[model samples]
Target: MEETEQKVGMLGSGSWATAMIKMLGDNQKKKKVLWWIRKEEDLNYVRTYKHNPTYLSAVELRIEPKNLFTDARDVIRQSDIVVLNTPSAYLKAALHGVGAEDFKGKLVVTAIKGIIPDENLIVGSYLSKVYGIPAENIVVIGGPCHAEEVSSEKLSYLTIAAKDTVKAERVASLLRNRYINTVLSTDVYGVEYGAVLKNIYALAGGICHGLGFGDNFMSVLVSNAIREMETCLTAIDPEADRDINASAYLGDLLVTAYSQFSRNRTFGHMIGKGYTVQSAQLEMNMVAEGYYASACIHNIIQQYDLELPICNMVYQILYNKQSANLEVNNLASKLS
Candidate 1:
């Protein structure tokens, strides 16, 4: 690897992580994309085959074999930009031995769509508070794009957000290619919270779908969700001048809430069909961001004294042991 080339380190090997590696590789192989694969077996397989053995198996990996590392700190130590792509629930564990200084001067990008599980904080905030990384150095990836579609080389859109426009543009430039188009935003608060809230709404949509609700009600549910999202976002950050209809907010909400590839919706569908949370997780072999986000967002709602009916409904069903049928029915009457 040339020392002059930009080194980008990837911290997760899940479907989204693999898709990002694909985007970066597609944008330019000159970036020297380094990946931290958690499992040694997966690492060996990718090294040997040039494709992730488990996630996004069909998409050919554009990463160089020599850049794969099992230790996350090692990857962070070498890269100019570090991406945190692991599920938010497991993020703390993923950075096990790394210290704040390891991230001192690096640009940290978050592709995580969920809040930090027990922390009740968004990934960007968590990075700032825990690692001492400044807000300007962090970039957030927002999407209406699905990893499955990205793997298939379908055109998808991602929003790159940061407090600093220069950093956002740099990350956007790295991620954009023929299959992926990028938009840059400075509303880090709005984009991050919107991404987290969409999952809960998507899970709610899935539960409604599993309960046999027709498209008419689903449309009503979505319309109300976007309003609820706008309310919550504005309350959370009164200074952010967000449109709420941008690709980062409403567009992402629409896709996650309706897309067939949405794991959160799938998880909610299973829950509506009487599957336990543990069972649904085991069956899907994927983490539904909403399952955790439901609880986290619920906490945020209470702390902020914000009344988000859609998110409240999801929280009740998932964490309160309430009947999905009854909770959603009550919610339906409340939706305009």
Candidate 2:
């Protein structure tokens, strides 16, 4: 297929989805991009106003009116590549009527940063098992990049991982631009697991910050978080050669743990300030992926008998209702 003729579809409508659309718009080769938004009102609003109504409202949309859709299956059926950018918790629900047959021959890319709640599977594994997509065709997008920064065209780096390096490069080509630098890797398992684990660590960082821990402590916490991440990633994919120091791993962790735009950290901050898990979730307009990830990773640790102290602490505070002060203080003693 010709590069210009390859049709790409985006599933979900959120800040990250908006950012992807903006990136595709900047692609000099592709003229139009397909977008699937769940709500009729949102679809109409974007078509009329050329911008997402609720998220990333300031960025102007460049997609054609005919390309916007409310039906996910239709978009999947028509496009060669489908990008899944929905929150991990809602991913299954969003694809309600879509099935394995619908995903055949399509290149699936997941921009979701959290693991599937009950399944304990990352997006790539979930799609491969449930939707019957080939493992090589599944791509995972990881970042040191935030959607807010992408919207403003700020310089950002994205790591694209697949078992097939050639396919990984193709997807990277579609997303690369002057401001968006792309790096390709074949460590899909490591990249996906690292992405999921970082959010949990970011929450731990936020909780500490909200409790009045200074920059010095945060540096130590994040350093320990990277060690925790390396251990978890190695357990999941021992054969995949990966650098724990790469932007995909350490840089992503640092950004989420420190950035004002990190919803996971914000969610954690609220928890440290004495809010209940339900209350923190209710108050925020966005989904804090770490909240769901904490439970998922906690389950994985139990199954694998892994010693991930930071993940355990976040899980205790969020799921077990242990006080953040008490749990985090205990966590502090264990961190080097």
Candidate 3:
């Protein structure tokens, strides 16, 4: 196999997972793309039709039927790289019964943007601490890039982050195509935490929008949000030398907080429109990571004894049952 054609396995079947398959193929490489789809019917569906019937229903899978599995461990066993794209909330259950030895020597990549719910650990940390994968062997994919645009072949950029530059570039090779640009970073914690915080911030943006705040107020909100993000990232990993304005950090925060494709923003908009958290989730039929992330982050802030108004306001609204109207009013006074 060519260096770029390292047999890569994917452990998801959602829009991002679908888009990843597209990236691997569109990069025009000849590597085998293995996938672990949960449902047998969906597995059969993609195997027979070359497209996922539900998610991203358009791009051809390009994966051979024989390469698809319902078992995640099977996919892990056969590939040199494993991409965990499942929602953070469900990841533990998704990888249930797969032991630490299963991850030995294989490079682990997390395309997940949320923190693991109960543990409050980002996917990279979760994998390192729980699965015992060496920090250098772990890689993370962060965006300004969304799966929706990637499926349509729109130009987008991704920052592939790891402690090891060689490992980061290795995964970047599989994702860089004519339409997708890949940048490498050693700021592993910054990239992962930035991805998580951006969702919380985006949810706040959506809530503000649904409450009738105009672009002028939004500009202020975003400017403030970035500063809050910088403060949080620095507190989390002081040793990581990173630009807060880099595509992995600021670019991700902007798109998530403003883009129509952001499910976190969509979920927050629904909350502002008077839907209960349960009801909004039922309506979206999607997981808005920030809804869960808000609670997890609130706990972290308490441990670090940090003061982040935007993140706290979101946590209060989502978890503490504070009025959205009241919270926003309080939050507005804090922002410049």
Tens-place lDDT per residue, model 1, 44-103, is 999999989899999898878889999999999999999999999999999999999999
RMSD of each: 1.7, 1.2, 1.2
How accurate locally, in lDDT, is each candidate?
Answer: 0.91, 0.91, 0.91
Candidate 3 overall lDDT versus native: 0.91
Cα misplacement distance, residue 205 of candidate 1 (Å): 0.4
Q: Which pairs of residues clash in candidate 1, taking residues 3 or more apart in a chain or in different chains?
A: none
| Reference-based lDDT, residue 89, model 1 | 91
Specify the poorest-scoring 10-residue window by lDDT in model 3.
1-10
Error of 1 at 121 (Å): 1.0
- Judged by lDDT against the true structure, how good is candidate 2? 0.91
* Per-residue alpha-carbon lDDT of candidate 2 for residues 12-39, written as tens digits (9 for 90 to 100): 9999999999998887765447999989
> What TM-score would candidate 1 get against the native?
0.97
Off by over 4 Å in 3: 1-5
Reference-based TM-score, model 2: 0.98
Selected candidate, larger lDDT, 1 vs 2 = 1
- Lowest-sum lDDT 10-residue window in model 1: 1-10
